[model samples]
Target: MTTAAMPATPADPGAAEAADVTGRLDALDDMLRLGGGRLDPRLLDEAGALLDRAGERLRLSGEHTVVTLAGGTGSGKSTLFNAICGLELSPTGLRRPMTSKAHACVWGLDGAGPLLDWLDVDKRHRYARASALDTARSDTSLQGLVLLDLPDHDSIRAEHRAEADRFVTIADLLVWVVDPQKYADAALHRDYIVPFARYAGVTLIVLNQVDRLQPEEVDDCVADLRRLLQAEGLADPRIVTASAASPDGVLGFREVLVDTVAARRARAQRITTDLDRLAERFAGQSGADEPPAGVPAPARAALVEELTDAAGAPAVAEAMESAYELRAADFVGWPVASLADRLRSDPLRRMRLGELREELRNAFTGPVGAQQGDVDNALAAVAETVTGTLPPPWARAVRAAARRHAGELPEDLGEALKDALPTFNQVPRWWWLIKTWQYFLVLATALCVLWIGLLVAYGVFGAGGDGANGLIGDAGLIPYVAVLAVCTLGMGYLTNLACRNMVALQSANHGERMERHMLDSIERVAEAKVLKPIADELAVYAQFRKDAAALRG
Candidate 1:
């Protein structure tokens, strides 16, 4: 038995529709890659395989729509197949199953070989109406159609059934041939018809052995079959009653086939149905009706605060303040007082601020044990806040993304702190002027004291008391020395007071600067370690949702 290929017809009406479906499939492929492991593996694989087949069909034989005749044992599928082609192509007998392998009939041989190759049908024949009888022939309507007679779906041999099922998946249209006894078979309805509910638009049901039934009972049987099909979720399915043995009985079925081929919409409808099925399977993973709003600001601030605490930023800032105050005091305080300050340890050195700065510049190296717990807790809190309202799969994905760099966060934060620490050892130019003025004051005080000592020595050690007393009283030097010494000491004291006040002001300014730097560092760490990952996951989710909606459409 041989079958013919569809004839070349006018421009394909399904080109635009096919393009739309192809674009949607491409979007779905991108979404699957973006979603990573978040989507169900099995569903993804099934969708991927179906898409490949659809793409291959569209590329190889888009101009031809392939329809298959599938049915159970003793259903006369082959007989109907031959009757439709108007030739003795497929053999028929009382055998349990007539056709074991699929046979193809193409109306127009152009561009049909590749499609037949994809369908794995080797036996093929071409049939074209002669130009002389074109006006009388109705078969011209089925110009670009490829008709196949598949092995019985209920064949006793497992391979025959498998072959039939394989062809059913690839065919653009399916025509189920049922005899009177098996029109409502439980296995057929439950396993085949129910599962293909999405393909109802491209499916046709035929009662192939209706000639055996009483004339009065035909209508009742047809009505009952319609109800059963509708119950199986096929609404208003096309049902035709025919007998391949009677030429007139098969005419109605042939007319329907002709119309289907003429419309050229079956291929597009089949692909659209497949896409819808995939969309439905993945709908559960897309949470809520719409994409979520961005993460809250307060939550972000809180996360930064937590990270700062974890990184010991406050401790470092306080140390900066103390170090600045100590250095300032040593620079401007009275010589005597500053000596005591210098004897104590420098706060910045004790904290190793200089070494930390060098380390930050060269490479990140610092211990973060003090605030590691705080950092982890902060990260967890931020992840929870971002994913709290998401569906389970998406929520988990977001949480995982947040912790993608968990092990590196502590080290990164420590390096950030090192960078934030302020330099306190720098000397200002004003200190030099202040030091010179203090030196002059010391000199004046020392000169005054030395002059007073010489006067006292002259008074105590003079050869005669009368002379010394006379000279001292004559010069009035006693009060002169006393006033000079008092004035110089008072001036030096005032100078020390003024310098102390200036140093205090400078320390306050430096403290504020250091605080700002520390906060900025904390914000950066929060952005890199916690916030970026959450954003990435949300991006993938958004794309997934968009693609799913397109496929649904």
Candidate 2:
């Protein structure tokens, strides 16, 4: 994933190693960001410590390596520390715990002052291995080494043992001292070796006081100790037999230190091992592959549909259709019929749907309706669908994300649906034309009836013998009037039928359109309040798994 070209064969191997370490650290930063709270808190803390230690170590000095000397109380640990430092910096006597605190003997202190401070080594206990005059030529090979002597791990005082444990955790290379008598101490193997088995590469075990044994028996003791260490999960454990009393007793162990220092890789190796163990712990809590892409489409659709029903969309849509039909009839129906319609309540108004948007402004604050359970079930289904394929912890995270904004869902849906409903304020031009024509027909029928009645009145009063014939040029006013009345009324009836048919079609279309808009609104609310959060969490997991796999590698 790095675009920067690295040398096919690096001139300096340390540079390449440094670049590799930087890349790993960067990947670890990503892992911490993506998987921080979702993973176990203890594991997260370990990762954070590793990052901080790596950063501080790299900043202090790459030239110096911090190697800790650790062992049980009678393991000759202080004696070995003095032997390595070539000075009696740590007291060695019959004292129960000779080194109650940590002491540092730093070589090449050119820039190691801050490092010692970072390690919290007391000034009184600090010593210099190489002087300014360069007089200690024999110690030149061990330059750039910051050797630490820690308190006895098996000390009677809990504080002493705790101090030893703390140094062991932060040391770049651990030199464990054990006497022949307590080489197989269970506390040593269980408390330290087995728990830090991943640190085998950066660890060294020194078997002190081998001079107490027969020369021939020393090899047998070393071999047996090696066997025990290997059994405790350290493959090919490094063991050295030495004595603090003999001048040349630790020559072989000193040579191992020389090689470790010349390599200048112990610090990076320690941090890498820490990262590897942490990666393994993370892998245990997650699946090998990434989780599924997201909640399936059908599941999302089902959720939206459920929400639509719970929001009363269907009822509102049906009311919209009935309301449209009633209003259309009032606009285009015959005059007498229009007046009758005014007496009947508007269907939407009767259902209180006209005020629905306003009423819903305060609704769904709690379980206020019969459909609230449906909403809850739908939300649960969405959460399950998103998290079903995830590992337990990650699944829990995803489920939590889904429900984080659940309480706001109802109000969001109400707002969306309120915006979705159409205002039925506009009327079609054809309705006005039909209404005018129906009123015209009604007026013509009324006039025709009046004319027929007036002609009859005149003939009955005997003032005119041919009053009926006088009308419409002798075609007979009665017959003409009768025909005009029937034609007008019949046309009115036919027009009403056509208008009713068109209103029915229009009403059905309006109902279908409203249903679609409401459904769309429900989907938007679902996406904003539910599905988006779930998707965001899945994205986090996907990236976390990637970074974790890189760490494992």
lDDT (10s digit) by residue, model 2, range 1-553: 1335434534433555666777778778898888777888887888888888887877777788899999988898888889988888999899788788899998788999999999988899999977442354444378788999999898899999888988898898999999989999999999999998779999999999998999888989999998888888997888888898888898888888877876788888887887778777787766866587778899999888888888888887787787777678767777765556557855655455445434443343444432556677887888897676678989889888878876766667766666776665677889999989999999999998887776666645544555444563333467878998999989998899999998999889988998999888788888888888888989888888777777776
Clashes of each: 14, 0
Per-model TM-score, in order, reads 0.85, 0.89
Off by over 4 Å in 1: 1-10, 123-136, 339-370, 443-451, 462-498
lDDT of each: 0.76, 0.81
Candidate 1 residue-wise lDDT at 207: 92
Model 2, runs deviating above 4 Å: 1-13, 131-140, 338-370, 459-469, 472-475
In Å, residue 165's CA in model 2 sits off its true spot by 1.1
Using lDDT as the measure, the top candidate is 2
